[model samples]
Target: MPCYLGIDVGTSAVKALLVDEEQRTMADATIPLETSRPQDLWSEQDPETWWAAVQTAVERLCIRAPAAFSGIEGIGLSGQMHGAVLLDERGQPLRPAILWNDGRSFQEAEELRRFHPELSRTMGVIPMPGFTAPKLLWLARHEPETFRAMRMVLSPKDFIRLKLTGVCITEMSDAAGTWWLDEAARDWSDEALAATGLDRLRMPELIEGSAPSGMVRPEIARAWGLRGDVTVSGGAGDAAAGAVGLGAIDDGSAFISLGTSGQLFVTTHRFSPAPETLVHSFCHALPGRWFQMAAMLNGASCLAWAAGLLKSEVPGLLRQTEAAYRGPSPLIFLPYLAGERTPHNNPYARGVFFGLSPETQPVDMIQAVLEGVAFSFADAKACLVQAGTQLSYAGLIGGGSRSAFWAQIFANVLNIPLSRYEGSETGPAFGAARLARLAATGEAPETVCSAPAVIETIEPQPRLVDRYGPRVDAFRRLYRALEPEFRNAPTGW
Candidate 1:
């Protein structure tokens, strides 16, 4: 049986998976990469590091099962979205790749709103500093030498695609996050480019997410022990791929991913942002489809922080504290450890622990983290509702879903059941593999989603529903009350 290789360049690591046409995993490998924090509130990584990690992962996957490489029919790349990777005239990285989590361009983003109010109005959303366009503007202003030498701009995944096929290309799903895409038209927005003072000519050729870009280069093919003729498909952003992996492609079906960051994704046929600009509107992995997404800057990271403070891991700690967390804790944690993105877009926001006293124990901290993340999800869900997407329930994925306790907490707080898949929690790499299959076979994305197994369903407890209803309302108000403070606060990473 022919297999497809899916490469997912994530924030912390590069993951590669070999999957057969029927979606059976043959082998997988992950290589860790380091991210740099040069200053508080800034995040960056060398693009060369990502390439190295990808190369290592591909080689490892082949070693795990050499036969898998022979059956490899195609390759696809998915990655963290919204990062800016500038390449010079000679195709060398101009500087460290500004990451999706970086917040150094807020002042620049503000200038965009001031100078391009009309463009913002038409786009239906204002640019955040963490977005690609603002980062590019920052580079243009601060690094004139590098800016002058720039020949092409691409996201992290696009850079990898270039390494694989020697072609400069990007897909709509990733492009939609760049603030240059006209979400409605599914193409680069001329008005946005003119308003932002960016050169549209420098952008990579836009293609459908499933379109085949080119074959893998012979040198990389030989190094990784793969066929030189393996077709490379245009993969999508991580969130879109995650949705595909979870089989959340139909309207009314939603996918909630809780990784380092958290996002609530609602599939939609039309392009629309929430009236408050709390959620992002982007093209979906499915060609010509769109989605509205709300992101939380810190989700599982909050729990991870608490675990680090206690010098423990979340899985083991949660297992010990699960039975003890019966009701809400007095301690409330604001999970803005790295500031916030959705609903506020405030880069100066900092995490806070309110109501902490001598009585607050490790279990209390763990409970606070879980509740805080759930509260944020409630806020995101409200944005979806405001946009007229009535999502009654959501499919859950990621490390957060492994815990039955956290899943129940989320269900109770959101007041909706959580649906889960049975097999391995395939992340974006699995989704990319499915996309490659669709490209090769001409099968509809929805058709491939058939017979996805549901492992469990978590329903909200009726008794906790009334209790959490007011708690969620209070969570929303707390953010509003702290909005001014967050805007004026000193930077804290």
Candidate 2:
């Protein structure tokens, strides 16, 4: 049986999966890497670290199944989007990559908005600090020597693709988030390049995500115990890949992913962001399609933080909370631990806990976190509805989706049904494998994805929906009231 290799370069780790043509998993390996934060609001990682992680994962996978490596038919890669990786003339990294979570480029992003008012008018969104173009501009202004020596620019996964295939290339879905591509034209935008003072020539060749870029290099093949000529396909951004994995290809279908961050994505045939820039518009993994995405910077991270504080008593706390709650609690939480992305792109926003009284208990805190995340999603859903996209049901995935309690909370808060799939991996690694299979055999992504059985469907209780309605209205008002304060707050407040 022919096999394929799928590599996902995630924020905290690199995951590799080996699967047969039928998309059955054969072996898997993961390598964790450290993210550096030398200063406030900065995140970076070494490009070499990604390559090392890939090498280690491939070596381990080969040890588990020698035949899987020998018969590898193709490879696909998925990774964190919007990171800026620069290469010098010799294709060596000029400096550590500015990660997607980094917020040092706020000034540059502001300048971009001033220079291109048409961006909001045409694309229906404004450039933000977390995007690649502003990061590149930040480097250009702060580190002139490094910027002068730059020969090529790529995203995180593109760096690995270069090491494997000796080619520097990227896909449209990833490029769309770079602030360098025309979303409608589906190519590099000369106007954007001129405004950013970047030469289009420095950009890599763009290709569709499912198209093969090149074959594996002989040296890399030998090092990883794989055939030299294995095809390497161009992969996509993580959100797009995750959507593909969950079978969210058709229009009107939605998927909500809650990991370190949260995203509410709806597939659409048109390319348009909300008029207020509440969501992002980008190409999907499926060719000739697009999606509207609303991202929340701190979704599961807040819950994890609360859980850590409670430690061994987490289950007990949850159970106690279940015992005490006669109905939805009166407290509300603003889950802006890392600031927010969609609706309000305010980096200065801080997490807020309102209606806290002496009577509040640990269980109430846990419930607040759940309700806070659900409230954030309600904001995103409102944006989608205002933009004329209708979503009656949504597929839930990721670590947060594992909780039946949280799933029901989301269903109740959103007043919609939550669907889940059985035998599915949580991240984009599985999506990359499916893409690899489709690339190699000309099979359709929809066909393979449709076979997964529905594991469970969580329906919202009427009482909870009625209770959440007024609270969601109040949540919207609170953000607006605090907007000015958030902007003026001290750094890291």
lDDT of 2 by residue, 354-381 (tens): 8999998888988988888899999888
Model 2 poorest ten-residue lDDT run: 444-453
Clashes of each: 0, 0
lDDT (10s digit) by residue, model 1, range 272-359: 7653566787888787678888988787778888999999988888987787877876667788887788877887888877778887
lDDT of each: 0.81, 0.82
Candidate that would win on TM-score = 1
TM-score of each: 0.96, 0.93
Model 1, position 247, has a per-residue lDDT of 78
Task: List pairs with backbone clashes in candidate 2.
Answer: none
CA displacement after TM-score superposition, residue 269 of candidate 1 (Å): 1.5
